[model samples]
Every structure is written in C-alpha cells, then in structure tokens.
Target: MPRPNVWRDSAETTRLWVFDALAGFPLILMLLHLRWWTFGVAVTCFVVFGVLERMGYSVRFALRRLRAIAGGSVKLGQPWWGKRQERL
Candidate 1:
C-alpha cells in the first residue's frame, strides 16, 4: 500500500520542525554573537525556511524549475523536470 502523507500527520510535521530547529540552532546562536540585528534576520530566515519545508517546497527543486523555465523546456501547468528526452 502507498504510505500516508507525512504532512497530513501532526506528529510527523512536528518532528520535521523539531529537527529543522535543532539544525538551525547553532546558526542562530552564531548570528546572535555577531550582532543583535543579525540574530533577528537569522531567526526570520529559519522560520521562513521551516514554513516552506512544511509546505513541501524545496530550494533545490525551485532552482531546477527556474532553470527548466529559462531553458524553454517547461510549459505552464507542467513539471519542470523529470523523465525528459533532452538534457536541461
């Protein structure tokens, strides 16, 4: 059977955020030591990234999508990458 969606499960989503927080904590701390304003920026960036992750968005995926669009390979309402006959 196909597995249930992780985002649909509250426990799984919470776990995902927790791990993200753990990974971001050190970066946030470093920013705080550098400057108070930097700390705020770091926290804001982390939160934005966290929300995007929760929404199933990936920066790498977006970059590839943009590349595909620039390459004139992808059309509107279609995937930018995957099983392509031509190289991107």
Candidate 2:
C-alpha cells in the first residue's frame, strides 16, 4: 500500500490542526488573560513554527525531485546539525 500525497492525506490534515492548535491556544489564552507578554510569545512561536514547517516542505520537495532523478532510489543525507559543519 503506497502512501498518498500530502494534499490527499489525513496525516497532513491532522498536522494542520495540531499546528493551528499550538498557535491558537496561546492566542486565546493571551486574549483571555489580557497578557501582552503572551501575545509576543505566541506570535514569535507561531512565526518560528511557520518557518520550520516551510523548511520541512522545501526539503520534501527537493527529495522528491532527487528521487525522480535517481529512478526512485533515495538515500538520506547527513543531518544538518552534525558535529562538523561543512565549509561551503
């Protein structure tokens, strides 16, 4: 059984709700408590998560193209946070 595309998958839909809850819960709390600090924290956290999610999608897109180029044979690359940083 092959996996479905992200757009057609329940997993992605569930993730969307989870992410929304992460940001929305903080927002609602901030509003109810009238805390300006939480507003800042919530906005910052939301932005960070948004950036991370975009990075994840970008990496997946890149890997998909690479798999197509390699005839569906794909190998994982070294972790970006590995001990030794590459000198590009």
Candidate lDDT values, in order: 0.62, 0.63
Clashing residue pairs in candidate 2, if any? none
* TM-score of each model, paired residue for residue: 0.37, 0.41
Clash list (residue pairs), candidate 1: none
Best-matching candidate per TM-score: 2
Across 1-88, the per-residue lDDT of candidate 1 in tens digits comes to 9998877766432333454544365465766589877677676766766676678865445447768878896565746675457877
- Looking at model 2, residue 36 earns an lDDT score of 79
